[model samples]
Target: MVFKTPLLDKPAPGWKQDLPGPNESPSIEPYPPVLSNPPNHVDNVYLELARATVRTRGVGVWLTFLMFSLAIVALLSLIAYILKEGTMPPPIPGIALLMGFIAALWGGVFIWRMDVDPPRDEPIRFNRFRRKVYVYRFHHHGLRPFSRTAWGVRAEVYDWDNLRAEACSVYGPMGSGGLIETVTLAVVKPGTHQVIDRFHFAHEIQQGEMYWAMAQLFMQQGPQALPAFPRPPRDWNNEDVSFNLARRLAPKVQWPAEIDLESRTAS
Candidate 1:
């Protein structure tokens, strides 16, 4: 005997109303294409320097102050201890005071150097048609304590073809340490192999990939080749193809024998 099981006739609660039916098409608007800055007349790839956060600067200042305070307190305590003990050694009389003085001097010098060599915000631009890289740096000028009363911008240009070699060095605690990796890209002089410029990228691996792609594009493309920014492949970071390409192109860079060294040096 054949028997048919009874089917439930009730509709699932709100299922038909909430979701599109098999024959119905959902009403969805397609996302608009993201618009980027139109390629310049000569197609340039521009990169801006990363800026430090106010919190980061605040922490740095606090750390510096703490270090200075600790140094001062230690020096004062040592002086007081020596005075109370009334101990004098023939080999090094007033040794504690001498050490404290040296420590204070070292700390003062460190703080002075840090203040003089403050971090700069610089942006770099690469021109494919002109085969030049431009770096823009801003300078501040003022009198006495008011050091930042006025500002000026300076531009430095370097030849793309003169880039003899390029290298990316990765350093940081890998594995389980959880420290972020730091990458440095250095451009070297062709024959001398001396580093002319170095670019540092922190945490962001995509920036390093983009730079390596640019280097490869510069090497392989002809002078008249249309200027285009190299797009990173899907597996750019996974396989480290950018790093490999940079290594391969480094040895192939060559400068014309007749090129004037002085003019190159000036740039």
Candidate 2:
């Protein structure tokens, strides 16, 4: 038997090729959107605010030192003037000088401590759910999680939770000359008293997206009251691509909600 070729076996016809319209571009599908740069004025203002916040911390430190130094100089001058006058500087005046000395000493201690003290501790609780495979780090690492970068900070996702990877923002510097970025997911239930990873401060991946994702995730499960985290302006928008992706990927079984009431109260 002779072997036949598939394409050559088709019937031949008088062919008229249809072409694209004169002005129409080739029909490639449009690409999905990534995050857009915030509008000019809005972004400028936000950057300005962020820059100001970083600078303000430094300014506060210097201000405290200056005040303490001024207090010491004033106290010494008062003592010298009182001794020179040789009249005990009056009962009322001497008492005022004494008060000034006390204030100076206290102020100096406060200033020194502010610079040397450990970062203010916020109540944090840690838990491991779903074996070593799933661990969650949440709540009150104080300035560690929110105030600093979040690149490599330990984050948690329920095994059953869905992650909408594209919609999240990953921030900060990654190792070996690579930039750091974060992708976050939606959790069915919230956990509590999580110890924050301090080592990840400068390497944050989800500095901006976490607040928005958390808010929407909380809203999706019925209308019961939930504890509020700080609201960022971006949280106002509805239904991001990530939310849709997460809905598709989310685990079929919901995780039980866990509470940490004993560790601390919202300040």
Each model's C-alpha lDDT? 0.36, 0.29
Worst 10 residues of 1 by lDDT: 13-22
Q: What lDDT score goes with residue 216 in model 1? A: 40
| Candidate 1 Cα errors over 4 Å, as ranges | 1-56, 86-117, 136-156, 164-180, 191-202, 211-267
Give a tens-digit lDDT track for model 1, residues 102-215: 665455444432333233233344544445555443344323223333443445567655432222233446575453333333344654435666444222333333333333
Task: List model 2 lDDT by residue over 1-267, tens digit each.
Answer: 111321111211211111111122222221113222111111100110010001012233456667677777768768788688866677777778778776765665544333323221111121112111122232223223223332122223332222211221233364655543332222222232122221111112233233222222222331132222233323112324252332232222211243222111121
- What C-alpha RMSD separates each model from the true structure? 21.5, 24.4
TM-score of each: 0.42, 0.29
State residue 263's C-alpha deviation in candidate 1, in Å.
17
Clashes in each model (backbone N, CA, C under 3 Å)? 0, 14
Top model number, lDDT: 1
State model 2's lDDT.
Answer: 0.29
